[model samples]
Target: KVLRLWLFCQNVSFMAAGVAVVAILAYPDGAMAYNHTPFICLVVLINVCGALGSLSTLAGTILIEREWAVVISEGEHPSFLAKMNSILRRIDLSCKLLAPVVTGFIISFVSLVASAVTLALWNILSVILQYWLLMSVYNGIPVLSRRGRFADESERVGFVSLESYSGWMNGLVDHPYVSAWRLYLKQDVVIPGVALALLYFTVLSFGTLMTATLEWEGVPTFVIGLGRGLSAVIGIGATFSYPVLESRISSLRAGLWSIWSQWSCLLLCMGSIWVKERVSSAYMLMGGVAASRLGLWMFDLAVIQQMQ
Candidate 1:
């Protein structure tokens, strides 16, 4: 029931996002050339849509990939879980690499309006296919359907619960969202989760900051895109390598290896900071960031399997 409700909400949100994007591009003159009020309103609407899409994606990932994977792999050997996790990561990375290239090609050659239309259409159409796929998976897997409710009666509470709080301070601490964080913090896997998050926070990847910095240093767009593509390739390689390494050494050791390898590659980036030459520093920074993806992804896979 929860899954169905979430899926329904995501479908509505995706369609709304599509409509908002189309509306933005429908202007006769470009947004900046025309009145600012409508432009601001459209921007806010799209931002909200994007946020909702992100949340929906996150929720769907947790539901299908993490929870369902565990349910299906129950009583199976750990390698089964590892394989499932790796395959999903591989597909995810592939899509991440391909989607941008495809979209960029369209935007560069076709038109921005066309690209917006394509995006809106994709959001509208893909939701139907995604819903079908998810439902089919649930139906096909008997164990998934057999799984009982995760939340206990004790876990359920109103958003504003007067009874649970004995004092004013208790109310703040005992808030449901706060309680969820408290429970997560107590888990053994929290360290691995933190490690994963730290990797995300790092600037070594092909993030917007590094891309802008490289461009500012007079690096060509082609080189930047090439470096980003290479990073994706390296990350894909990690997905392949993780299973073999895990079979030899356990997940924990694999994680250690991956993290150390990432740190070692990132040394180039640190060295770049000290370089006197601007262009050289940018290239060095880009190289370090690209190479680090290998370890970063392997470490990511290792952490996920550990959690599972």
Candidate 2:
């Protein structure tokens, strides 16, 4: 089970590296030249690679959180599991914020192909680190301790988990023992999940295009990078307030409020794009972007808490 989980995590990140490496090879002009066929191909490949990586990681997280949370929280005080999950969420948020800054800094200094190569090397090292970590810390990280591998929780979350949808159709469908919707997707759960997912998709999927739009409006690359970094900083800062908000209202309610707020900010962000050739317009756009991230993080914490 540990090996399977590791493989899923490994492939997700490894294929992300593949996405970058493929772009380096397939893009005739740099990625900046978006109107070309190769660029379109790059975008399609990236989305596909990113989706597979995400699905695998999500499956791993489900297995870990559901099965291992009990293990970690056992004999612990109230809210211990919750707080640990929060820490994990914050770690993911930090990565989202820092990645663009790191990538931009590298791209600013290096050739495009060189930067892609660097990204690929980074992912390779990450895979090696993951294995080393599995040996040293089991599945759990070594946050503040050094101890048989902390704990692995190597048991499968369930057998159904190992089977991909394609395999499920081929093997599980209509078999005497088979079932439909073995895992129920309740409407309440689905709605917030979709909302949270769409927010993430909007920010991530249109990111390159948004940057390009800013460039078209005369924004410098470093300036755009700075803006993204700022957005992340704002998101991180907003996370600290989630507890306060949850205390005042239900988590789902707080999440709904955040979703509404983000849409409002998105309108303002769109408006900023029309302010052509003005220096303040760039700042305006940055402000909008930061607002969106703030709403996003707030809603993210809220929904996840409610789900848990």
Candidate 3:
């Protein structure tokens, strides 16, 4: 019930923000000129919206993918959980590839105002659909309603009086966010988790910087999008390969192999640094990143499964 209510609020917040942003930007004189008051306000508003959207996305993913997934697969075999995770990741990757392409197409062919209006309408519809789907899932799964609240109730600490503040400090230290990090740090799997997290910080991937750099080096937009699609497809292949590898070797061994393979493939990116030709270097970098997705996803699956 808490998760459902939170999701409902998230959808409402997202929809309201989306509508407001669209309305502001779609106004006749809403050009974001440098010295305009409205432009400054709009910039601040956009940042707020971005922060809200990011928070909502992270919360939703944790609630649905981590908590609800575990509840749904409570009594099922391990493979069931693996399959669910794979499906979730595949859908996420597909969206990552498709959303940008579709948005780009709309922005290129249609007016900016048209794209904004389209997105505003889509957000409204998506809010309704998302709430309906969440409610349906909640109704179908009785255990989910009882899952998170009761298990660790005793561990929740109360605050102390203002004089000493010891209890307050303890409560802060024992808060779920802090406690989660503490627990994670204590676990053997922390190494792999850190390794996975580090992947996000690198520019070797086909991220925004890399994409812009490739384009500046004469690679076409279509080629960059094609590379992104291919990378996603290769990443999806990890779902199939992971089970086989884990069955042959242990999960930890599979993870080790996967991470090493990713590192090895990244040698192409390193080699790109020494290449004299700009276009050839860009292609080399892109190819390395695309090829690395296979091992990246494999390692991701391995670490996630291990953590679960």
Candidate 4:
């Protein structure tokens, strides 16, 4: 079971790395040029890679559960079909309760590709904002922890010890399954998303600077190519940093708080967008967004400190 899980996790990691590579390679002139053929081919490849990666992860988890069930049901002479049916029944129940998990994976995969394409179009800032919102929701609420529920008759509010908290967090950090998710979050999701955003900004900044410095007909294209190269480098760097960042933040709850604060700021920005009309009015709204993102990070830090 451990070996299977490890292999599955490795496959997902490779797939994510491939996506990052593809994004870098399929830059404006190479894959996304207004020319139809290359763009279509690249798009198909991206979709295939992402879909396969997600399915593999999902399938691996299901298999692990099945194995556990089989072990626990020792000596039961259930037929293959009966076993399959039993598994499916459990899956159905899970799907009903956790419908959003499936949806979240799908959305995350789709948005990743879309963000890459958007960056190709030189819409960097917009792509960044879109991903920031999506991931904030993914990591902050449903994925990291479940919604808070009222305490029940059997449940009591009690002081949790620092030692206990440390042990729990350490187990989460050391466990392969938990580590896989953390790697996915930091390397596959956050890094790629941030790289795309940075690429967009880099291209936009270059274009702005060049427009100010010199006259050119194809400056945007130049910016796109340069940004793509930079993004590739960022992707590579992120791959290397994944373990380091995970180790650093594993025990530090501050990082989680930062994420939460950022999410709150994101919500504020969304609300501001709905209420404010004028461009001039967006400054305060933008501040709110920054504050929220910062707040999440702070909250994560606080949690880590408490655990410590």
Each candidate structure's count of clashing pairs: 0, 0, 0, 25
For model 3, state the Cα shift of residue 218 in Å: 2.8
- The candidates, ranked best first by lDDT, are 1, 3, 2, 4
Expressed as tens digits, the lDDT of each residue in 1-308 for candidate 2 is 65457555657665575666656575566555656765666667666776766777777666455545545666775346446555666776799877776777777787666667776677667767766765464435443233334244223212354345566575665343443233224334767777777776664322778788778878887788777778777777766766666666757677788878877887776786687757677667667777777678788777666555
Sorted by TM-score (best first), the order is: 1, 3, 2, 4
What does candidate 1's lDDT look like per residue over 74-170, in tens digits?
9998888888888888888999899889989998999877877787687678777877898898889887877454656345533345566677777
Residue 161 displacement in candidate 4 (angstroms):
28
In terms of TM-score, the best-performing candidate is: 1
Candidate 3 lDDT by residue in tens digits, 1-308: 55656665565565656666676766557354544776567657666766776687788887777778888988897777777877888878878778877878888998666676676677678877888888899889898777455456335433223355467786777577876666567777888788889987788777889888899999998889898888888887887788778877867888899999999999999999999999899889888999999899989988888877
**Candidate with maximal lDDT:** 1
If scored against the real structure, what TM-score would every candidate get? 0.88, 0.64, 0.85, 0.24
Which of the predicted structures, 1 or 3, would earn the higher lDDT when compared with the native? 1
Q: Candidate 1: what lDDT?
A: 0.82
Worst 10 residues of 1 by lDDT: 153-162
RMSD of 2: 8.0
lDDT of each: 0.82, 0.65, 0.78, 0.42
Off by over 4 Å in 4: 1-276, 304-308
Query: Over the full model, what C-alpha lDDT does candidate 2 score relative to the true structure?
Result: 0.65
Give model 3's clash tally.
0
What is the per-residue lDDT of model 4 for residues 97-216, given as tens digits with 9 covering 90 to 100? 343344345447775555444333432343356446535644554422333332251134222333655766866656657644554454424553453344234312223453433223
